[model samples]
Target chain A: MSTTRLARTGGPRPAAAAGRGRSLWRTVRASGWSYAYLAPFVVLTAAFVVYPIFASLGYTFYDWDGIGEPSDFVGLANFKQVATDGYFWRALGNSALYTLVLVPVQLVLALVLALVLNNPRLRGSTFYRALYFLPAITSIAIVGIVLKLMLANFGDAVSKPFLKLGLTDEPLQFLGSPHLSMWTVIAIGIWNTLGYNMIYFLAGLQTIPKDQYEAAQIDGAGRFAQFVHVTIPGLRNVGLVIVFLAIVGSLQVFDLVMVLTGGGPFYSSDVITTYIYREAFGQVGTGVAVEPHIGLASAASFLFGLLLLVVTSGQMLAIRRLRARKEGK
Target chain B: MTELKGARARRGLTHLVLLAIGFAYVYPFLWAVGSSLKTKIDFLDGGLGLLPSRPVWENYAQAWREASFGTYFVNTLVISVTTVAFTLLFTAMAGYALARHTFPGKKIILGVILATYLLPHGYTIVPIYDLINSLGLLNTLTSVILAQVGGGLVFGTFMFMAYFSTLPRELEEAARVDGAGFNTLFFRVMLPVSKPMMATLGLFTFISSWNNFFLPLVFTLGRPELRTVGVGLYAFTNQTTTDWTLLCAGAVISLAPIVVVFVVAQRYIVEAIAGAVKA
Candidate 1:
């Protein structure tokens, strides 16, 4: 079967090379066009994407203000500072909180919406899907800005009706109060990206064959039982991927927080990205002026990246183990 | 008859629920556009009402002039277009090569690409900033465009590679039978045939570059005149004092182009995203 597959694919096979050197040279010559084609991408990625990662690692060791060369070589001090800093911890905790709240809530909401819109019998499913997804395509920064303005201007507008209905006597400060800011940001974050997850869930729903539902019905399964037995199990793989993507995306929340509150009423909504941005480029939109600390920011960034790596790999391993145990059963 | 009526009622409820949620989802944008056209006093007093007593068309013009949005709009266009063009060309060539040819170091390249993709680089801007500074391209549109293009190439290349791999081998053979050389075949046949993929990638790139705030903000820190609409709007809020109508107008202006793009290409964009997640 493998040989037939290879034959069908039809690629140039080595003609029993007498020596490795000659075949290597022949292969290189044959791939000239490939090298030519790959040159630009290789050059650009190496320069911009890959090199910056290593360069930032190097920057983490020094106390640089992003002005001149790194004459002040403070070894591990930046990392130590990042490790011990209160604001860094706050930012890290905020990011974790954001992800912890966002992923499950957003995923559940998305799945429910997907199920609703996935019904072929439902009229105007396409229109509903598009309507839900419209915000996902718009810039998050714009969304944050518009929401900030609306909340500021329309705070009374929203509160008046609620107050009259006796929902609450007091108006809410969405971005002002320290207690409310992070939750408010989380709510907006969910709204902003919910559509992407909804679309993913919709696609996953399509992949689960209709025959499974029919089979469940034949077994006297109710709607809820069929969902539990067929839908959940069928969506397991795609569900894992969606969860991973959502968590990763949430952990890097910068634009919205930066624009909305600038991580403030006093570091309440500061996620790791906003923390890094503030350190690297001082605090913008705030009246206070602070110096840019590139080294500390780099350290903070690398630390967060390391944490993400561990979390993601652990998730992957858990997934593998679960899959293996199921197969074993 | 009663059972059928019950089913009909259930469907109506579903639509009702969906319509309500959908309205809430889209209400903020609708409010922004409405507020943009409202007089300042009306905006303040209208509270939840979407219509203005009289439309304030001057708000958009004032936003365009006062915020320097015209310049920022032009800069954003140039940067997004250049970045998308370069990204498409470079990624297509590399993707086609990777898909079609067997070469030494291919595994290494693929491995590096995968590793980079997995590792989050949200904070790598520090070094990238330093690198661009050293190149004497700091505060220039070129810096922003280059960074955007470079950062996107990995994902674009990966996408194009998958797309190219799915194309039938018979097409390449046919081109070769017609005495087409590598360059001729790719430029004339392969690239043209790949228009749909290009559109998908191009639309994605355009939306991202158009909406991007951080890179443009950081790169153009020294030159406020060089800000994109996103950065410019942010600055407008900071510089001006509670010009709520103008700010709303500015936000709407910045958002209009991208919304139009999304509306026009909604089908392709949705499919592309869905396809990407599944893949």
Candidate 2:
């Protein structure tokens, strides 16, 4: 079917002998099939992913309500507004703080879990693995709601233990206090993501051959020394992937924050995505409905997206350089 | 003999530590399930104890009736099923083409997909919203389905590509020599051999679609009847924030399908994650 279509569409061709022409026809036929396979995916991705990316980039340079077309072309005004806006910087800082605190804690805990459970001799390792990973399956939105309730001012779930330990005399408003809210969110972030990260590390751990450890033992190396030498290097790639994912994922944290704090208690816990939400849709209960400013939201997100692209690209470049230097040594 | 005893002791210590950590990890979920059966007063008064002095199963009935979870269930099912079906087929086809064929512009196609892979959903939400609005597809399940599948296709293709690349080329060569067409070769031969990858991709697409919050939230803003379970529970909690018992019941209701899918296909889920990151 496509072979005839290819022949019909052969507008330009290189002059060649009969044998070469046959092979060229064969090449065209093969490409026709490949194009058929690729057509649906390329079309859909262009419609949604590629086109929307450039569309949003174009939106950043204009001032438009979300409903209609961009009438006013305001060059750099929206970008300047977002850059100087106090809330935007605050939200960005909060997101960075969360990532800073959340990534190491999550990675370390997950690595430790994987190391402990990587033992083939351990009984019920599957059960433990499944148990640890249970939270990953639950929707983060539900997790946020449940965590919010558990940490409520009068709720005894989180407060009772702290009270018994005499950590605080009063039942602390974990979600209500501005200072404590972000920390609570960060803690929940680690909890919700711990299992998934552990799975990554576990997969990484499995790929390291047991012979390496045996060789280290033959050389009279201790467990800690072998781990430092062999395990770390073996896991370096997986660790980089995990860390990059954790950073990007935490940077865009929204659903949990939406359901949990709603950037509450004087907007102390607003992250970048939530800030963008407010810019686009306005705050939920601010008496009068604020106008939806799609242009400003697009600008903020565009800047944020650029930052993400640069950070990720930089990370990849750094990793590649490190690997090359290590190989050279 | 002493080394053997020492190794046993170390293993015991490890198990003890793991058990304690695992308990802490899973306790919140257990507590939520326990709280659902308690009365409001009982739950507040019972503190950390998981046992309910009064077991009230009616909470499930009430949450189902009041929250319209039945409607949400069907709505989410339709969205998730259609999205997963389209995502699996489209991505698999793309993956097969990329892996098994040589073509002009192939590098550019792969580059485009990879670029889109790194583009986070946060930046695209506004334009996607505008795109949906312009197309007059807002507030419809189809809009969410289209967006979700498009978003998922890249990673799915990545996974399938990795899997397909590892397969030996001889089988395909033999089939091609026997006059098998491309479609027949893929569906009859390659698809059967690629079951594990398909399972991994399908489970992932299903779970993410089922648990998806942002797209569904933004798309179906005012359409309560068309809300997915995630958004339905969110709305329920917003309306009844203090009713812990009812909220827990609603949470349990929403979690059931995903929990079942996870328990059934958990190995593939983990493999999918591992393969995705590695690929």
Screening candidate 2 with a backbone cut-off below 3 angstroms (N, C-alpha, C), the clashing residue pairs are none
In the range B16-132, model 2's lDDT, one tens digit per residue, is 988998998988788788988999889878776788998999998987887687788889999999998999899889999888776657779888877777656557898888878
Model 2, C-alpha of A28: deviation from truth (Å): 5.2
Reference-based TM-score, model 2:
0.92
Clashes (backbone N, CA, C under 3 Å), per candidate, total: 0, 0
Q: Candidate 1 has which clashing residue pairs, if any?
A: none
Candidate 1 local lDDT, A99-165, one digit each (tens) = 9999999999999999999999999998999999988889888878988888876777756777899
Worst 10 residues of 1 chain A by lDDT: A1-10
DockQ for the candidate 2 complex? 0.55
**TM-score for each predicted model, relative to the true structure:** 0.95, 0.92
Q: What is the lDDT of residue A100 in candidate 2?
A: 99
The candidate maximizing lDDT is: 1
Model 1 misplaced stretches (Cα beyond 4 Å)? A1-23, A161-169, A322-329
Error of 1 at A124 (Å): 0.7
